[model samples]
Target: MAPKHDLQYPKGAQNTLNRYSDRGSYDLEKVHKIVNSTPVLHVSFQPDPSDPFPAILPMIGQMGSFERPSSSISDPLDCYLHGYISSRVMNVSRAAIASGKPGLPVCIAASKVDGLVLSLTPNSHSYNYRSAVLFGYATPVTDTEEKEWAMEMITNSVVPQRYDNTRIPPIPAEMQSTQILRVTIDSASSKVRDWIPSDSAEDMANKEVVDKVWVGVVPVYETYGEPIPSPLNKVEKVPEYIEEFLKESNEEGLAYATAAGKRPLPVKAKTNHDE
Candidate 1:
């Protein structure tokens, strides 16, 4: 769980961090990998009255990179090849190295997946979601070999086999021009709410009379359609590999389609509005 002090930060930052904290810990490695892989990260920070903050900061700047386990191997290239671009800002390059802060760079994120589950009684309303927030600081990657490893880790984090398919990253000059920040998390917290609708006896009795409209729920979901080949390409048939990519279940397909400009199919699931 994230410390109470950390949660006091900007709501927008918390939201962003929560969106990417897939496995609990405000995972710096995952966050950095996702930020670099995805394009157009949404970032917002209001200046604190007590301390002046940068007015026009980049989304990618808000979160910094972090170290990963020596043995762990996750490919980010797969995500890129599938069309998921990293959501980040390039301005992280300008942040000062010595802020004089004692702790490492830390960030918090939170998210609510569904609408508030309104109960028949006003007091019973609740929400269904999974949220996680983290706190940590970033360390710049300086070693040439380490930087190369970091880039590879970032790539593998998204796509398992991407490094094998793509050319190796540039060396020396190109690598030197790029900056990599490593984040070290201090603490984190996770919360969730998944429940079915429940109504009070009085509300149930008055349901039809109070509202003549339909009372049952209408399902909502995420879905995907067959991939459309690029117009410029002249392939006789959809490659089996590409077709396999299309067969992924809805959420995976939606994540992939988000960058491809393909419309995601709607999945059928009950909604609060329907009720």
Candidate 2:
């Protein structure tokens, strides 16, 4: 096994961070962390060669290793995406594999805003966020065991232990209707800005601009509110698992965002390519 810091996706044109490169990282852990944490990942692929536009779909995705179920987040892992069998992306991936192509070439992106950076100038205004982009080839999971495992993995990602809590095993119809796409990532990178506002030196020199403009960070985070029971909910009260997940997630999100708002900017611009 390689050392933890030695494990990283190779930097290339596809995954390089050009602008404000100081905030970028090619660390597999950081890239995967942003992807797994985000609620939705935007997957992009060209559906038709002749078409002018590429199709982008919002999907539920999780990073995990079926072969090594106990693997840590820092380890290399494939991205499992959950969708309906009839979805266009699933059909395209299936066709690509059938045609002898490696898989459907794709780009997946996930981003979460930690704070709003209010600067003295509009050009300097920016968002404190964690964003990751992954380039990969996606193929439909054909093996029954792997598909079912991926299903359970993805379900639990939404809410911890949700798969076992709700239903034992999916009915045949339910299994038939769902599809899982395993993306073999070729390269990936993440850009994260979790710091206080940065203003131009000229603007800082002018105390008038600083005095007039409100320069600060407005911390942002996803909040999970009190769970509302479904109309047909038979359980008298919410399960302890659900309550615990909500409490833990909400607290973690708020704390991270708050800390990001107060952090100092990155001291230097660095990228994997620089090495």
Candidate 3:
């Protein structure tokens, strides 16, 4: 097996994981943490069993959702559904690995922002974010107990205590309605980007041109709204568990909840005070 550290990529593919391998390698610890921290995985492989596989899966699904997005959406429902499907796919991929049919590795990415840095040169433009990526085969949970635990891990992975608050997963007979797969990790890497712009010689020469326009980066962030109770449930008072979900600050959690058919919290109306 090619150690994740030894895996190679075509030129132009940034090797961000090289320096962060010790912390980034998708080992058991990282895998568990990742599965718990976020419920998403970007999976791709040569679908053909023969060589010269000339096809790639469509990036967007029929519903206008993608395995990966260049930018995050503000809608919590959209975000949650995206993560739910992504996590399910990842689980299936892992199950394939556990079945002894080791498939291609998938990429998992999580990014956080510190601040944006503006620069005088277009080439120097960038932002600060803490990100980690894992390239590994997901191991399957075959044991019934382990499988259930994996499911719970995935559930709580999205929203802490979510499974405990909601109904526990059904037995295999009932779960059969849903598809589940597991994968074992083989190798992986991690990386980060946090550099500020340093003006190059040409940029310095064109200082006037650079200064003529605004040259600062606008920071990006993910936020959540209040929970909208289900129409079926007419309880005027919201449950603490559901209310706590609203107080949580995970974009992935918000996305997962929305995808699971939960409604987003309503926006609070503001009052005009002493005019």
TM-score versus the correct structure, for each prediction: 0.50, 0.95, 0.56
Model 1 misplaced stretches (Cα beyond 4 Å)? 1-96, 99-104, 110-127, 171-174, 198-202, 205-246, 249-275
**Greater-TM-score candidate between 2 and 3:** 2
Tens-digit per-residue lDDT, 208-232, candidate 2 = 8888999888999999999999899
Model 3: how far residue 132 lies from native, Å:
2.7
TM-score of 1: 0.50
Per-residue lDDT of 165-225 in model 1, one digit per residue for the tens? 4666665666756655544445444543333444444665795644753322222224446
lDDT of 1: 0.40
User: Cα lDDT of all candidates, in order?
Assistant: 0.40, 0.89, 0.42
The RMSD of every model to the true structure, in order and in angstroms, is: 10.3, 3.3, 14.3
Count backbone clashes in candidate 1. 46
lDDT of 3 by residue, 1-275 (tens): 85544322222243344442432442333333333343344444443447564322212110011223332221110111122334545455555666677643444444455345566656565554445443444333345654454455456545558878775666656454433334333333343333333445555568587668565445444555676778797678876766676576646544433332222212210111000
